[model samples]
Target: MPETVFEVDVDAAPEEQPDPIVNRWHPDVPPVERVSPGEKFRVECLDWTGNQVNNDDSASDIRDMRLDPNHHLSGPIAVDGAKPGDLLVVDILDLGPFPDNEWGFTGIFELDNGGGFLTDHFPNARKAIWDFDGVYTSSRHVPDVRFAGLSHPGILGTAPSHDLLERWNERERDLIERGPDDETAVNHETHDDDPPLALPPEPNEVLLGDMDDEAVEEAAEKAARTIPPRENAGNCDIKNLSRGSRVYLPVFVEGANLVTGDLHFSQGDGEITFCGAIEMAGYVDLKVDVIENGMERFGVDHAIFKPGNVEPQFSEYVVFEGYSVDEDGTQHYKNANVGMRRACLDAIDYLTNFGYTPEQAYIILSTVPVESRIAGIVDLPNTCVTVSVPEAVFDFDVDPDSLAEISSEGRGRAARPS
Candidate 1:
């Protein structure tokens, strides 16, 4: 085990931690600790919502989730000799869940609150609890399926420079002001684009680590929200950032104030349901190094990474396909979002044949090791998207044609909105 430089209690609130856990991004957020080059260490993180959610069978916790103070990151761990224009090389040595707490959750927020990619279709809040058994995880709420998790940090990045931060705030605030357009907001009445087009640097509910009281308000006012993925790679949710992965993060400020948290036990390609991944509090082991002037040498403007090879391997799959058309039959010109949502919905419909309800199928698609891809990008009017779910995950043969009825049974329905 590597030295744990940052640790937080899973049951306690992030603000009550011994070491500060921040949720915003800025150069002056204050580094919790410092590490030398080539040194390996461990970072323990609070769950994305700071454990406001419970392990029980109720979607109420998800329905009332707070997004402002979300994604409580572990640090601004300054690396010695790291400078601007350099690339911070972070090697993800290993990732593991807490021994005492071997369970995690996957949530689908209501349309009014934590809106997701398929918010229009599945508007109500729902949850699935998955218990970890070594590499494999099984959910009691939606039963008869088991698969290995590809553990990874959902949010991780270096701090932004003043200019970069300002640029971010300016553009994002503009988007918020402009609001969602007709295309994105396909439904204007019941299913609104409720979460807003962008989250700006608001002073309300922001945390800036161990900074003094006098500077808290000022710093919080300018700090960027940790929801969207930008040039620095905060909240990309790329599922590929697992153990043994090598991430090259662009450094804007000195020491490359690397802050990371929002760990996930497993996730599908899209994480389509917002808060959909098997959310958990876990520790990540990492080794840090720096590449002098590597950003310019590689012409890198944003964070780039090489994925790990430790993900679970499945031999066969049941592939579903969709086109760039809305559920209402509205045609869009090569829209990937619409296409992916269609693919996911199609899969969900097929899953219902196996005794899973629409909600259970949605949860299964969100938590499993499903693969999503854009099979055709150049085709006009409709871009074909494919979602391939591994057949081995199911106990029974997933041959839709062969099995005409419910061949499997769920433990119980996932918690629904009350």
Candidate 2:
């Protein structure tokens, strides 16, 4: 019999209704049954903005958007028997439409505002308008090719840490106190009547210019360590995180808090345009279960699974920035692509032990490996690489039973926090 995994609806409700689990921060002992390798559960996910936008939308609509504190994720379902330092294995089946009609994801504002690497080139204005058809075709594009710009949530994280929350609270307060930078004397041509402004630079807040290198480094380190994703979940934008591939994520806190809302119908590898995969009212089905004495929590950061091999092949996506030394004793900029090639080579070497011939591996990689993608290159240098190898790839004759065994073993290994 074909193994049947659970399918998450992806489109359910806006999560605007009052359910204790919808927006709360605490973990819950869910009502779902324990999931095995073949068994699956469906989760209904809410839109990122809780269904705040309409079909007839504009840049102003998103710009004036208010992100609510109370408006957070739905399920952090305490996996049955899941303990601290265990990985929550998730199989991403598919991501598609819901009952309602809203297409694409959000978070373009951040990408435009230098929060991401492409901010410099990508226009910070609301470029396109999504209509009722749920398809965003361009009037300027070539004929017959109706390109519907799909988008997904770029930010889906758990609840915030206490210290981080407190720090954020202070930042909010500073913003409220300082208000917009109303310095008319220093205003530039771009400074409109209502120019955007961030929080005031407090002594303890982010270090300003002229701070010592060590101090600056300390600030960056603190931010990286203490700051969880927007909410506590972490910057998890795995588009494949929909519902088929049993995904294993590390458990940082006692309760493996999971916030699922960033829903995208179809997104390209890099999400290059910065605003495809966009949709608001949708649902995600999930079953949060636990693993006993799990050991691969850290490995959750870089999920490694072999397609057919009994000994799972390792796979990881890493971005590297390249700098070449010029003849003038100075460093000249090399393309990020060069750096990506090196990283890809390294990853290939890692997978070689799992049974990939260099040639076979190259072909498999060329076909399956997703390049130029960014889980988050906002802070890192340009080069970004995202790759995945199924456990079955190792076995020439990947039968049903073998597939099951490999999947289960990968899951078992993945469950243990590394």
**Candidate number with greatest TM-score:** 1
Those runs of model 2 whose alpha carbons end farther than 4 Å from true positions after fitting are 1-16, 20-40, 67-72, 105-116, 127-233, 253-255, 270-276, 287-289, 296-418
- The regions of model 1 sitting more than 4 angstroms off are 181-193, 405-418
lDDT of 2: 0.37
lDDT of 2 by residue, 1-418 (tens): 2122212333333322333223322222232223443344554555545554544434554545543322334444434444456665544443444655544333344332322223332334332332224433321111111333333333444333446445655675676566643222112223233323432222232221223456554443323221123334443443444433454555445455444554655443343333333444455444344554454534444332212111112243333222222112332233333333444454445443334333222322322223343333343333344433333323232233444444322322111000
| Tens digits of per-residue lDDT for model 1, 181-217 | 6555444333344567787777887788988977888
| Cα lDDT over the full model 1 | 0.86
- Per-model CA lDDT versus the true structure: 0.86, 0.37
Task: Specify the poorest-scoring 10-residue window by lDDT in model 2.
Answer: 409-418
State every prediction's TM-score relative to the real structure: 0.94, 0.47
Prediction 2 TM-score vs. true? 0.47
